[model samples]
Target: MKECVLLVFLALCSAKPLFRPSYMTLKNMMLKDMEDEGDGDGDVDNSLFPTREPINSFFPFDLSPTCPFGCQCYSRVVHCSDLGLSSVPSNIPLDTRMVDLQNNKIKEIKENDFKGLTSLYALILNNNKLTKIHPKAFQTTKKLRRLYLSHNQLNEIPLNLPKSLAELRIHDNKVKKIQKETFKGMNALHVLEMSANPLDNNGIEPGAFEGLTVFHVRIAEAKLTSIPKELPSTLLELHLDYNKISNVELEDFKRYKDLQRLGLGNNRITDIENGSLANIPRIREIHLEHNKLKKIPSGLQELKYLQIIFLHSNSITKVGVNDFCPTVPKMKKSLYSAISLFQNPMKYWEIQPATFRCVLSRLSVQLGNFRK
Candidate 1:
């Protein structure tokens, strides 16, 4: 038995030692085993493992280029106003209907810049630094209705505007002249406001508004010394206030039969011809305040529909019976027409008391001071 044990020990010592790997070698082998268990395409089968999204995917940044960075998008309106934008933002959605980019520093509008935004209707760029607008800038937006470019630095009215436009407000601009073809295609326009422009009366050529059927036209504060000629007869309201017009000719508003409101306040008007307002039978309101008139304007009794007359802040000193009541007494029993005579030097004792009461009964007169 002792000899057998010695032989066994010698055999164990001589045999190659069993393959017992070191600690690092065993760890490497285990990692290799894990790699071998993965799919051959280098992608591990994470279906059983807990999945997690990348940390960067949870940010608030927009990756699509279809919308601008800071614009607020609603159903069909994109308001990028007051964003310190230097130009009209691109990538406006195709479904956008209105874009209000007002109060920006956009200097010009290049043609076809809004090409893809065909659904746009109202583009308000008011109070911008716009100096130039391509004639075809609004060509693609044919369905556009209102274009507000007021308070800009445009020297001339933009041409080739969309005919579908109903209201065009370019007030407070530097537009000096309106050519004959300035508004040729804008036939559907209803309101054309160009007030506070340095427009010369002669710059408006004959037939400048020939084909237009505009109802409300505002050309106030344009430095005009007289009424502009060839005005559209379809005008319902004509605002020519805050100008240098000193006299009103008889034929100034003869053709405007549909005119209801006429504004001539804040002007240097001192003389109004006898028949200047006789033809306008449907006249309702006339603003002649802050003028240099010495007496009541004639032909006020002809306006059967006249309701309000503003003649305050003038140099008038007397009131006549004929100035309030019509010669035929057609409007004697009608609603009293308000006549503002405040701030005048008319003394109640200077005029006949009976005549004054008669005029007051037919019209509502506002006096400065009176003593029975």
Candidate 2:
């Protein structure tokens, strides 16, 4: 009987462990981990979030159309323009700096469309179906600088533009022609690009830009047969690319003393005389790519300040002595002068027939000129 009592005592001692406080506490903690309570960390990682926040939302300004669904909202300036919107957003935030509404289906702009935007600087409405601009389209804001309306169905330039406007790009529109007084009063205008319009066929009369003060004018790729003689004297950069100009005289550019760059690429120019560019002394860069030419012009050697010259894809077969090295005689004065003859087949031999002639000609030059 005593032995039986001792066995019962031993059994009770072993079972006591199951009900102990430490063992129960450990078992409960293990069950919590097994139940997947986020690895016991306080923060939850959200890698599955669908969309990210906007960049302009942190700006101090109040710009906006708030963003559309699946987009984040921003403040400095909203870009809800390319959404094919028919009209401007109503609840756009104030103090906007710039608004881009390009490539949309917007048809009209009411007077109050941009009512509260006091700090708006640039407004881009290119490639839209805007047929009309309200008279007070930009009555409120005076700080607006640039306005772009290219490739639109507008019949005329906006008369609501501010005089303080510096740059205006309204090319490729339904406008027929620019009258002498169309942009005559814009004293601050500097750059104007009005190419690819069909207005020249109707007759671009003289003094079209009568009193305009633009410096850079681009009227290339408009199927022009003759250069516009009414160009401003202050015109600095002229791009007449892809035109039908086969006859370019010397005096055509004589009036533009301040002309810096001239782009006549992709034209049907077959001939260039010796003094073709003597008038424009300030010509620095000339791009005559894809033109018909047999040899380099003579007076190009006189352009003392010419820096870069591009003559790619021409019909020149051979290059003799002083073809490029002596073309610009004053190239030695400048530190750097780059001439690109890419896309041309130049067969320069290691030991050419005229190699000795070039060396002898250099030695025969006037000794006084070399010393001076």
lDDT of 1 by residue, 1-372 (tens): 999999999999999968978855755665576566643555432221214332223334423346677887654567889998999887787746788899889999998678877667788999999999998888788678888999999999999888888899999999988888888878889999999999878878888888889999999989889987678889999999999999998888887988999999999999999988887878888999989898999987666677788998888888786675565654452333577877766775576544433333534766666222
Q: What's the TM-score of each model vs. the native?
A: 0.78, 0.67
Candidate 1 backbone collisions, by pair = none
lDDT of 2 by residue, 274-312 (tens): 676888878877877787766655555556566666676
Where model 2 places Cα greater than 4 Å from the true spot, the runs are: 1-76, 90-94, 110-112, 115-118, 134-136, 199-203, 317-336, 342-372
Error of 2 at 26 (Å): 48
lDDT (C-alpha) at residue 220 in model 1: 96
lDDT of each structure? 0.79, 0.65
